[model samples]
Target: MNVLAFFTATVQTTRGLWRIGQTILGIIFRHPIAGTSIIPILSDGRIVLIRRRDDGLWALPGGMVDWGEDIPSTVRRELMEETGLELTKIRRLVGVYSSPDRDPRIHSICVVVEAEVEGKMEVQDALEVIEIQAFAPSSIPQEPMSHDHYRQLQDYLNGLTTLA
Candidate 1:
């Protein structure tokens, strides 16, 4: 009857149908979904991360790529929705992470990028992000990161030092 309940019911029903489609189509096709993650580095060299509401792990700002959206746009959209930071500039492509085991949710190819952000980053949606923080690469949490986020950070850091 209420809006929240109605939304929940709708989402649940949609999820059920989606899973059924996944099962049926997966029998013959291997289409991997696309996702985007952003590493927002500040002027002080600290990177921004969000504490996910579902798992309480501090991870990079990102989400699944929406249909008909380009990777950069997906990155910007997810960053804004999750971190409330507008993407002023995209620095570079960090990498394309496609390890099947990276995320347990589904088969996805995550395009990672380093981006420069403007404005304060508050958790825009409590359902997706619980808290937000910036950390020097050395001080980032070692365990319980949502997916392959820590590995992505290491790759980016390695590239940075080697370039210097």
Candidate 2:
């Protein structure tokens, strides 16, 4: 590996690297917008979920933020990109989830937000999503969810916020 890549990886584990990301997010993205994920709740009290085309596992519809994107905008953009739904109300920031192993990629962080829908919901990103449906929170399938999406849902269910 290149010396700088090796150095950042090595030094990233040092005591303050953890907070560095939060600090950077706080400064640049304007609220520690580590990354934005969204949980879209429908009017019937069911939450919208989707199965990834690549992995075929259910997950909340979201993706990485663009370099200059803010959290709120990123959440909206990803919601539209992944599920074709627009967020009308950001109920709350569900939490932040970042475990080294939570994502397959290194140095990747995710922010989870819960939102209410204002318009129609549809499966638009057919290339990236295989299935879309509204599911009761109580009936969520036990089958593994994509990228620890199940865990994020659990965190919301248990009223746990700000996971790291």
Candidate 3:
């Protein structure tokens, strides 16, 4: 190989090895995270979804469980932060997803819930959410969603409480 080509290949190899090393270290040092994904159903029977600023794909409105906070509190906080809606009631537990590959950013167990919500629909967290919209069951977007949200929604729609 020419000198320039050999140098380019060496740098690429080093970068790839560095990423692999980081992944290994992270797995050894870190633990699985806990989070929530809410299926926010308005009184009118529409579900609320948010367009994430990170990937620009629509996702359920929920977030991680904070320190000293339980799942129910996380659900309420995330619901308001992402959708600007008040939680009238947590109607049911949809599922608990714990696959290591569920969230690309980290190994997270997501507790999905169906909640009755009220108030105006707005994007409260501009840093994380781009836009917020409510969709009827038949009107939800058909495109691929971020994370395992598609599966979560399907489990709820099918009336099956999942543990995965």
Candidate 4:
């Protein structure tokens, strides 16, 4: 092979090996990440949910807690980012979910909170959120939701504080 072709192959091989090594190291040393999931209740008592762009399924509005940010801040940021709503008040803690399989993308511990929210419902993070809507408690979609959101919502609706 030409010297140029050999050099190109070597560079590509090195890049691929570097990526594989990074992935392995990341998995080995990674800890469970903390995040917040907000069950946003509007003034009229409707629950706000977002359709995830990744799975095209409805899930609670929430995200990973940014470095140096507390749970409340993460809740507020994620709520606004996903649903364009401002937190009026945090009503209650729905649960702390630490199951390794709760999120398919990563092993994340989610702090779920029921919060009173106000503002127009728009998709703030278009890349992550596909659609935003408010549903009556009795009318939440019955089909399986993204991640473990179904269990989270059910626990909230049942007035139970969970720790799992």
Candidate 5:
């Protein structure tokens, strides 16, 4: 078999086992609420990333959406709040992933969006982000992602096939 097929089969087998474990554990514990994350992109092709406050790891600048808020609005608001940039365009909706143990606090439905920045930004949320940087897609970190956001980044960079 080809490498892609082999990798996909392995992932499917692993995810199947993970789901079974989740079913057993969920009998006693409840999952956490859902959240959102945006992969902000500049017109020049640079992707926006932030240094997380809790850990000094880099990730996309996004957070949970408020109750009753729309996904696109959440992306726009998050981009503005975290990076101080207003998005000119919010791209199509990517796919959703729920691996049961992806998040430690709760089961989060991360709504990811690709967007283009309209202008410059100055990060306003001083507590959540330590620094903001724009890097080419090829320069992203390989491991130790801030909060599983890097998974979304990987999905996005890999033609967004799985996540889109």
Candidate 6:
């Protein structure tokens, strides 16, 4: 194989193995973890999503919560870190997505939130985020996405006419 292709395959394999290792470690050492996923909806009724640098799927902007981090604060920090937008006010709890076999790295609970934001959004962290864009709730991308992001988007959209 070409050198570049070989390197890419090697790295992907390593990452795959690392995730499997993490899952096994979780079984031995950790409980179901909690994380946040933020849905940043713009004034025009469009929702924001991030193209992950590693996988290229347009997922909602968010990250894992720190040990003592409040969920709103976690959403704020993650939004700004990934999209350069500050969370103004959390609109509502969009939904909670937790399945027994959702992620390979851990048995995790994802607390999804819908929120308003300030400032223009962009992909700020080059290592983790690749692009940021807004889409009408009806037209979230069809490409591969990170876990239940699409479902979260659907939940947010379905709730737009009422309280979530």
Local lDDT at 149 for model 3 = 95
**Could you tell which candidate, 1 or 3, scores higher by TM-score?**
3
Colliding pairs, model 6:
none
The regions of model 4 sitting more than 4 angstroms off are 1-28
What lDDT tens digits, residue by residue, belong to model 4 across residues 115-152? 99999999866667889999999999876899999999
Tell me which of candidates 5 and 6 scores higher on TM-score.
6
lDDT of 5 at 121: 60
- Model 2 C-alpha lDDT versus the unseen true structure: 0.76
**Per-model CA lDDT versus the true structure:** 0.80, 0.76, 0.87, 0.87, 0.73, 0.77
Clashes of each: 0, 0, 1, 0, 3, 0
TM-score of every model?
0.79, 0.76, 0.82, 0.84, 0.75, 0.77
Model 2, position 67, has a per-residue lDDT of 60
The clash tally of candidate 6 reads 0
Tell me, by TM-score, which candidate is best. Answer: 4
Which stretches in model 5 have alpha-carbon errors above 4 Å? 1-31
What lDDT tens digits, residue by residue, belong to model 2 across residues 66-129? 6677889988887886788888888987787877567553345788988997567777656668
Error of 1 at 139 (Å): 1.5
Q: Give, for candidate 2, the lowest lDDT window spanning 10 residues.
A: 12-21
lDDT: the better of candidates 1 and 4: 4
What global local distance difference test value does model 3 have?
Answer: 0.87
Winner on lDDT between 1 and 3 is 3
Q: What count of clashes does model 2 give? A: 0
